[model samples]
Target chain A: MQLAVLILEDERPVREALARDLGHFGGHVRIEVAEDVPDAWAVIDELDRDGDRLALVLADHRLPGTSGVDFLVLLLDDPRTVHTRKVLVTGQADQQDTIRAVNDAGLDRYIPKPWNPDELRSVVRDQLTDHVIEHRLDPLPHLQALDAARVMPLLRTRGDR
Target chain B: MPTDVHHPRSTLPRPTHLQLAGLVVGLIAFLVPLLVDIPGLEPAGQRMLAIFLLAIVLWVTEAVPLVATAMLVILLEVLMISDQALVALPEDVLAASDYFAALADPVIVLFLGGFLIADGAAKFDLDRNLAAVMLRPFAGNARRSVLGLMLITAMLSMFVSNTATTATMFAVVIPILAVLPAGPARTGLALAIPVAANVGGIGTPVGSPPNAIALGALEARGEGVSFLGWMLLAVPLMVVVLLFAWWLLTRRYIAPDTPMALDLSSSFDRSPAAIVFYVVAGATVLLWLTEPLHGISSSTVGFVPVVALLATQVMGGDDIKALQWPVLWLVAGGIALGAGIGATGLDTWLLGLVAWEALPLTLLVLLLVAVGLGLSTVISNSATANLLVPLSLSLATGLPIDATAIGVIVALACALAMALPISTPPNAVAYATGEVDTRAMATNGLLVGGFGAVLLATVLPRVWDRLGLL
Candidate 1:
């Protein structure tokens, strides 16, 4: 089973760009892209069917009908996505929406509209690392995508068995 | 806190072909001895042979978890051959509690202390800080830094589990790897930690499970090695093998002019609890080393810290709960297996199959080491010891050799089998870093393990005799 990252954005170009930026983690992690909330849910369904974990969701705050904040809050109620780390990657989120993302959705990180590729990758890495550690996942299979130093303590608990 | 309303319960694992084969073969192996009458063996011996055969197959194929197989051995011993056996044995039978006692065997208690202290060391960040401080003197040159890293790793591995030591050292080395030009130097640095950790595991009884298994088996036979006594027997081989590995890895991969320097900053924990832990940990080590002076058995010395740490509230119930019980239980299973084999006359029956005396003693020793090293190269080291230690101790009975030497050699040989990624957990950790590939690991592992094996087989036995350590 693989840890998967889902990119949910309304714009095709934005979805492509996010997928491209995360291309390095493609083989190590399953990267799925969806144009909107419906597509995102479809991707989650497929992931669950394939025995993949929805480890993180990178979503744009602006969507067509249901806002990203709404989806994030919805995720809190969905058992499958409750533990998934949530990130909002848009400059358009108002203070109220951002606050809900934090208070209700448990947003892990916010990537401003104009974000550095390096910082974006680092945020994703940090969030993924947190998800793995908090859930006590075996870090070896996903070591390349993780902050290697941060996961050493988890490895220590395995002992020599 | 969102309760995992839909927490994905894992799907039942599909058994592999090997596991299926193991189940079928194990049943056959277990039954053959019980059903077919042998001329010389007793009923209890036949029953034990069945359990032993089943254990060998299960451990090899890992049809079940290693610890599960271990627990199975204990249960089978109790039900099939103990005084509480379903079918009564006319021969003398040990009580079922005797089999259960393997779980709390003194050596297991000794490991309980070692693991707690090791966990405590990591809990307080003492291991990483100590690495930083101890690494200061060997900071600049590439080779010197590797040497320092290996020595410190081995020293830590002497107390900590080899896997944990490799992980801790890699945490320290990963940053340095990013700075250094990625090449043989990166490979060399990655390779160093595991080699040191595996070799270093032989340094003490509590260093690894195989040592505890060996010590436990030997103790059961009325031959116990003290904590210091084990060091005297194994440390010299450990130091020699580690130095040889350092030289091999450095010459093969690291250039002397390589720009490698270690960060040497350490802020040690100085809280009241930390201070109390420091003294308690210190006193425990002092007591362990000075076992000759204090005359306390290592297991009792081992347990003092367990009581002291809890009493002072430096460590608590949670810490006890988190201790590596699976490892402790696996060791218990091996002890039970050993006890059952020795008690039921299974060892004698099995040993009689070979004319072992016809083979020269040195050749016999070399063969034992080779089998232990080879078997553990692909299986769990503790499991290898669990099966081999009992048989070898029994083998030593008919021969004119120190039984302690045979048991210790087999245990050390198992530790020396680090030739593949699957060889040991430490090797697996190093392999996960992506710096050391299979080719690099196998070449380096073979060279170091081969060298260690040769010394262990040929030289170490004579050295032990000369030192009067046997």
Candidate 2:
């Protein structure tokens, strides 16, 4: 099954611009949108009922009141989510936290703040591919259930892109 | 040897009589010449040898209270050896008796003011607040965290005596130490505070004794240095030491470890308190720098009265009453000791031993500076200056040397030497950090000692010649 992408950011100009940028890839790469963690949580709540697997989560490090790292830590704790690539997008990431989350939460990569649109697509594509191929390539459907929510941005796509 | 291997640590037996005899012989090497009226021993030669050996002994045993060991040298006049003895004036020999002159000194008053300001900062938790706010936001990784600590400490040392600065930071740093995931981050902060404190102290005259002595001596001669002049020399060196050593060392040795600390962010989040801190710090810098403009010293710019008012204004009288009086008194006592040495002509007599036209002028000045800076490691900076400045003045006794330049160098050397803890307040505070071993501090000073001597040797002779001091 082809997976989807989710972009959650507070700024309208930024969120819409990213959504518009991602539309170029077409519907085969299903792109979702949310303004913040709460809105994103709501989207996850709905997805929980349907069992749609999220291919990648590109998150802003600084959201309304929550940190991207903290948010990722929370997402990783949930058993329902599996094999989601988390990308922290921020100008002000705790570099140390980014490294730690890569180890603890399976953080696949990050899209840094004021990100390049073309670059974001490539990183998301590469991270999702790497995540799926590394863990899901073995063909055990149960193995596709691991979460990348805690992975740090530093560990994310470069050559994979 | 086998029996010793099994001995318990605290219960190790006392030294035998033969060992005690060796220690007694070591003491006699420093003592007998000063006390006994030995014929033809030439008291100057005896005392010089005695002083040199005393330096080694102090560096070795360290059990003898350092100042007391310093004061014991006065027995040169007290026991009154034959023709070899150093002649003492009728008034006093012990030098501590000259407290009145030192208590009246403006530099001592300035130290009084500086300490008062530091004490007030502590009482009101200004240092604590500053540390909290600054340290709070840092990523506790090796490189970034070490940089944060160095920046915080280097700035603090600019105002407070490096010693007081270290103590102030140590209070905040110790609690957070446990929080850091162990590695270079912790080690860097530990090493940075003291070195930063000592290095940072070079910025402001009030921050260290050596600078004060340098300034006070120059001021006394009516050719004092301006604030800008001092900053040009001190600030650059301080920045160089802090950046080159603190950050680079951590990067090389401790990088990659992510150390964490008590999120000091929440406590100093208040803006007003932090503003007050900056205001006081700004005022101190302003006041110290403008001393050259004002006819009076910033120290005497109502050192006590201004602090009293500020304390009452900022922290209240109850806080003001709790100021560190012992330190103030000890400082005052140190000044008294300087005056005492001066009054006895011991300072001049010390000059007598070195005075000779046979030696070339530049070499002599450099030699004198080396001697002054060297003495300060064992003796306090103020006393070193007091002993040497008067001696510098005496060197001009019909000689072509510039008394002002000689005095200025002596004062500068006294402050900048920074060899051992006893020499400068910063060294003492660095020693007190508990993080630094005494041996390590002394060894580190060997580097500063070499740097300072080279600087003085190179820059001073030209400055002296230009100023017509040589």
- Chain A only: TM-score of every candidate? 0.98, 0.73
Q: What is each candidate's DockQ, to 2 decimals? A: 0.70, 0.01
- Taking all chains together, each candidate's TM-score versus the true structure is 0.97, 0.52
Interface quality of candidate 2 as DockQ:
0.01
> What is candidate 1's TM-score against the reference?
0.97
Runs off by more than 4 Å, candidate 2: A1-161, B1-99, B132-141, B175-185, B213-233, B256-284, B292-294, B302-349, B355-445, B459-470
Model 2: residue B2 alpha-carbon error in angstroms: 52
Considering summed lDDT, which 10 consecutive residues are worst modelled in model 2 chain B? Answer: B1-10
> Taking the tens digit of each residue's C-alpha lDDT, what string does model 2 give over A1-114?
335577877888888888887775454455788887788878776665554556678777777887666777767655544457788777777878788667765677766677
Off by over 4 Å in 1: B1-10
Assess each prediction's global lDDT (C-alpha) against the native: 0.93, 0.56
Candidate 1: Cα lDDT at B186: 94
Q: Model 1 misses residue A50 by how many Å?
A: 2.1
